[model samples]
Target: MYDIVIVGAGPAGATLARLIGSKYKVLLIDKRDMENENPKKIKNKCCGGLLAPDAQKMIAQLGLGIPKDILVNPQLFAVRTLDLNNNLERLYQRFYFNMDRDKFDQWLISIIPNEVDKRLNAYFKSFTEISGGYEISYIYNGQEILAKTKIIVGADGASSKIRKLIAEDISSPEKYISIQEWYECTEYTPYFTAIFDEEISDFYSWVIPKDNYLLLGSALRPREDTWNKYNLLKAKLIKLGFTFENKFKTEGAYINRPKRGSQLYGGKDNIALVGEAAGAISPSSAEGISYALKSSLYLAQSLEEGIDGFLDRYNQRIKGIRLNLLIKNLKSPAMYNPFLRQLAMKSGLQSIR
Candidate 1:
């Protein structure tokens, strides 16, 4: 039996595996064949692919530096905040990194020790309680596979199967269907921009420029009107002097935004949940990489203490990070409220001159 089984190989799962894979008999499972599978055919993450300051701090705490190859062209210096409702625009200084999100995830997976059993193109189904641990069942290569693990970790994203088994007592945070589209460009856009239009979404939308493409993405409520709002956003940006060229790719994914600390579901029994699986994401900004990295680090430290009573330790350690996420919820209203956002932009508070 393996000592631990980690579900999902995104930032949280990959980081967790990298940290404790050497110490434990670990099985790392991921649905995507990131290495072999053609990215165009698969549903990739719908992210702006920009690393925020909080994520940078977590990377530093882990004593690791991002490789230069993972970075994208035109390193950003400022964010142009657009108030579509009031015709106000302001530039805010930024230290965020523009990188290839897929490559970054692959790099994290690459660092994992060879001792860990890395399983790709594996779809997790369910788990059941057993004598010493849990019996995990998954579908891999057109066959149902079963395994035993003393401890299980759900590092999956917002719609986590493992979390469903454990966190029934807590309701999931607000769920938003994030949609992003890539457009080919003749020239590179110089700055990253954030657009606020309550008519489009209550959360936010972003325009980030990569090498020869521009990424436009938004977090919107999942409803029949979702695409209508997205199309409207594109139309709005066109009026704001942003040129749209031939469309290349589009991606959609589920992202959970928690408004309170109580919404974060850690885990129970020998199972532990980390990253967006536990709702450890920002309600204000919908930023998750920082929380994903921090939660995995906290889980790794807890596992280091010993598998016995590890759940309590993991949950206890997660409290601090959850508290921080809760605080972000407090700040969300100022940005989401159109009147307040216009006031802040007009006052030029914290906006770089």
Candidate 2:
């Protein structure tokens, strides 16, 4: 029996494992094959792959240095905000490190202790409450395997199956379908562009320049016409002189859009949650790496120190993060509200000349 079963190997799971893997018998699991020794298919998040300033701060606090290989071309220095409805464009000074998202995840997994058992291509199936702990079942190579663990941690992303199977009350966040596409770049697009079109998405859409390709992504409401909205966004961006030579690959996933602090929870009882699974992502910007790292770190401190049963301590420690998310929600109207955003753009409050 393992002490803990982490159902994801993302930043949250990897960090938690790195911190407490040596202390406990940890079994880290992920649907993606992130391990180094075995060669298998690769998978990762559908993210913009840009680390915001807050993420940089978390990395600094963790004393983690990003490797050169993880670095991608065209490090972003500014954000180009486009209001398609108002036909207004503004540039704001911002610092973001463009990196390879998959490679970054692999690095996080690589730091995990060797003692920890990692299984890949294993899709979580179900779980049952046993006498002492829980029996977790997952599909490996099309076969089901069972393992017992004292505690289960849901470090999975917005669409965490672990969270769904959780016994305790979980604050549910609004889910959105995020679609990202990589296009072969005809010319260099330097700025990280933020597109706002009510016709496309009430949340938002983005364009980031990766190595030899431009990654265009959107957070749209889940519906039958979701692709229609995405297509609308593309048509609007094209009108703004954006060119796409060819589409290379498209990736999509379910992302959480937490509107209230009450939507955030650190889990309860034997089941614990960290990262986006716990509604730790930003409500305004949708940046998750910083919150993911912070949540996992707090959970680690609670587990590693054996401070009052991990769950209670973990919940208490994450209040600041939840509050931070609420504050971002407060700031959302200024960015998302079309009239307010238009006024702000016209005023050129923080926009670069």
Candidate 3:
């Protein structure tokens, strides 16, 4: 039996394994195969791949550095905010890095200790509580496999199978249907764009610039007319004079959002949830990398102290983070109003001056 069984090899799972694998018998399972024969067959994370400064700080705190090759655009230094409702545009300078989402995930997985048992192309099917540990059932290469562990970690993404089996009191977290369009960036732009259009999304849409490509994406609240909303966003981009040099493709995925009163890091019967599985994504910005990395770190540190009452300690630690995010979430809807947007812009410009 393993000490811990992590049910996803994405950033959260990989970072958790890297932190505690040396001391524990860890098994990391994922549906993605980084070494797949066909490159196109690899997993599509369906992310804008923008790493905010806070995420970079946490990565450094963890004693890790993003390799140069993984960086698609390292000089992203500004964000262009488009208030489509008022036909107003403003520029705000912020430091962020654009990356290849898949490559960034691969880099995270690569740093994991070789001693950690990593199972790729494995589909987690179910979970059960056994005598002294938990039993996890998964399918590997068409055959079923069962593994037992003292602790189970749900580092899985938004639609987490582990969370479904483990978290009984908590309902499924709030989720958004994110759609993205990719195109060749003929002209290299050094800044990303944020589009605020309440007519399309209650949250917002975005246009991200990379060294070689441009990505336009938006998240909707799980509507049937997602495509229609995307089309409208596309028309808005065209109106804003965004030129596409060679339309590559479009993709979509589900992203979790933090909900008020949600238990971000808690578990029952030796199973703990972290990352998106625990609703760690920021409610206002939908940024997850910083929260994901930090959540996993919190869990690792707590577990190192003692597995007994670990979830309690983890929950206590994340209380401040949850509160801060909830406060921002409450104010986000106000940002969509033209008057508030203009006022905030004026206030910001005055502060800078």
Candidate 4:
């Protein structure tokens, strides 16, 4: 039996595997094939692919260099915040990396140590507790497969299957569907754009420019009027000088916000939920990569202290990070009001200086 079985080979699972795979028998499973070179066949992460400064630091600490092929743009130097209601715009200087989400995920998977049992194209089915461990049922190559592990790390995304099995007592957080569309760009901008308009979306919208393409997306509350709102956003962008072809494709995924007191651990069980599965996403910016990597690091450190107090330690660390980020996002509500947004923007600029 393996020491740990990590589900979903995204940032969290892959980083965890890299950290402890040498010391423990680890099995990293992902539904996507890491060997696949075709971009069209890869899974879409539905991300704007902007890596905040915090995430860049984490990667630097891990001693990993970003592959050139994975990065779509060199670096974003500024952010353009647009107040749609007031027809005002403000620019803030910041440094962030813009990448292709699919390739970035693949790069993370590629760094996992060879000793870690990396299984791609393996679809996780279920988990059942057994003697001294859990039996992980999965489908591989049109056949059923089973693996035994002492601990289960649910590093899956927001809609985690492993979380459904373990976090039965935990209430789910507020969820929104993120819809994104990539378009061929006629002009390039050095700034990433964020737009706020309560009439279009209660959450937020972004326009991120890459090498030759621009990705526009918004997190929208699930409602019957979602399509209407999306169309309205499209029209608003058009008015702001964005053009899209009639035949572009769209991608979507679910993003979960962290609840105030949600459980990060599965009640003293051997299951540890990390990343978006445990609501480690930022409520303000909707950024998740940094949390995914940081939370997994915390989990690895906790597991290093043996199994007895690992769950408690992991929960404490994860919860501390979430609460801090939430508190930092306390200013999010002000973005809905034009006057408050302007004031907040000014305050933010002053603080940065």
Candidate 5:
């Protein structure tokens, strides 16, 4: 029996496991094997991999250390926004890190103590409510193992099995599908750039600079035709003075709107959800690494403080942030519009102060 059984070993699961490993018996399960660094093994995620300024603070609070090699000092010189005609409009905000998702996940998992049992290549089979809590069944190396636990956490990505099993009543809002391609540039740029296209109304392309590569991707609108958004964006990049020497990889995923309520703590009993499973990604930027880290820390804190107190504090802390972003999104739908995205970018730059 485990105190908490966390499904999925991404940023959220790994972080939570590390935080609670010392005091509680935690079982972290993932479909992938231990040290599985291949992005293609699972669904390739489309992300800029930009960590916000507050990410470091949250990481330290969780008592986890980031590995040195995975860190890229993307001292952002400027963020340039271009119109449909490739006209530069705004440039602001400097300094942010560019991280490789696989490397980042590896580093996060490395900090966890051995006491926390890590079950790799374990596919969650099903669950049933036991007398006190629940019994989770999974297949590991073709054998089934039933682990009884008092608490279960769904740190799984957007499509969470634990969430489906537990939060059957909770609903997820419409999701925006996004596509990304990582290109190894022949020449490196000093700044990060976002190009807005009037055609792709709700979507935008981003070029994040790393040591010797550029992370480029497009966030597609819900109903829009995604037929050739990647190729279109690649062509646009070439137009914007980016020479793509090698196409390293491409990935895509769905991002839920920010207005969706917390999908973390569900049921009146002992089940909890964190990270994308809980819909923690920011709707505006579709960035989730920071939120995953932050939410895991908060979940750990809540566990330490007892259930009731944790619920109250977690709701209070996250409600305002979600509400504010949702309201902002509703008031200015064009904030996502290509033409008006520059203004939104400018606003973000101003808020950095």
Candidate 6:
């Protein structure tokens, strides 16, 4: 029997395995095959892959080292308001680093120990409560394997099967969907820019700089009109000097918004949910990697203290982070207004003195 069984070998599962593998027997499972090396084979993740400064700090604290080359240092920039008259105003103060998500996730998994039982191409079928822990059934290599685990962690993406097994009373929200496309560029700039419209009502587009390419994406409320809005934004971008010489197909994914009553823990017994499986992303920014790492760290610490302590710590930490982000998002529309954007930009420039 293993101490922990983690579902989904993405950031959260890999990080947690590395964190607790030395001290405990852990099993990390993913539906994707381990032999798959092609990045395009994985699900098309809709993210600009910008890692904020705080996220960097958390990585250091967790001892999850990311290579320097994979980090894209973009010249500090801000949100630009695309006004009705086509006037542009910039909001300053926020700075971030663009990243390649595939590289980031691959690097994270690389650091984990080989001793950690990694079952790629394995799908978790179901779980049953055993006497001391839980019995996990999974399909591997066209065969089924039953493993006993003391703890089961649901690190699967937003739609988590483990979550469904654990939180019987939780409900998820349907909010905005983010679509992204990557283009290979012969030449590229070093600035990360976000183009947004105040009229479209909560829709925005971003151009994130990478080493030799640009990651372009748009976010909008889910509706039949969303595609039309995306087309309009794409046209505007092309008109405003942005060009994709070598184009790639577009990819999309949905982001859950400020939902309530999602349970993070199954019960006092053994199962816990982490990462997007628990709805940890920020509603406005859709930032979840940092939270995933943070949640894993919190879960590891909690395991060390005891079950009750773990639950308490998890609740306290997540509640504070979620509530804070909600408040900021609630105020972002006003903060991104044209006048405020200009003033903020001017103030930022002045502060450099």
Query: Which candidate number has the best TM-score?
Result: 1
lDDT of 6 by residue, 1-353 (tens): 99889998777788889888887889999986644687667654467778776677888888656687667655444444344323644444566666677677767777888789889878999999998889999999899999998888899877778877777676664457787777887565655666757554364567776666777777777775887877777777788787866766677877655544343332335777777777776655667787788877877777776544566666666665566556756756544565655555555553322
Candidate 4, residue 255: the lDDT equals 91
**Model 4 Cα lDDT, one tens digit per residue, 89-177:** 78878888888878888888777788999888889999889999899998888999999999999988889988888777788767899
- Tens-digit lDDT track of model 5 for 140-237: 88999999998888888777777677677777744677776667764757777877776654546787877677777777775566756667777766
TM-score, one value per model: 0.97, 0.96, 0.94, 0.93, 0.84, 0.83
Candidate 3: tens digits of C-alpha lDDT, residues 234-329: 987887798866888888889887667564646676888888888888877888899889889988988888778887888887786788677867
Candidate 3: C-alpha RMSD after superposition:
2.0
TM-score of 2: 0.96
- lDDT to native, each model: 0.90, 0.89, 0.83, 0.82, 0.71, 0.71
- What's the candidate order when arranged by decreasing lDDT? 1, 2, 3, 4, 5, 6
Per residue, candidate 1 scores C-alpha lDDT tens digits across 18-71 of: 999989999999998866647664446678889999999999999889999999
Between prediction 1 and prediction 6, the one with superior lDDT is 1
Query: In model 6, what lDDT does residue 60 have?
Result: 82
Ranked by TM-score, the better of candidates 2 and 4 is 2
Worst 10 residues of 4 by lDDT: 259-268
Residue 35 of model 2, lDDT score:
64
Model 1 stretches with alpha carbons more than 4 Å out: 37-43
Error of 3 at 60 (Å): 1.3
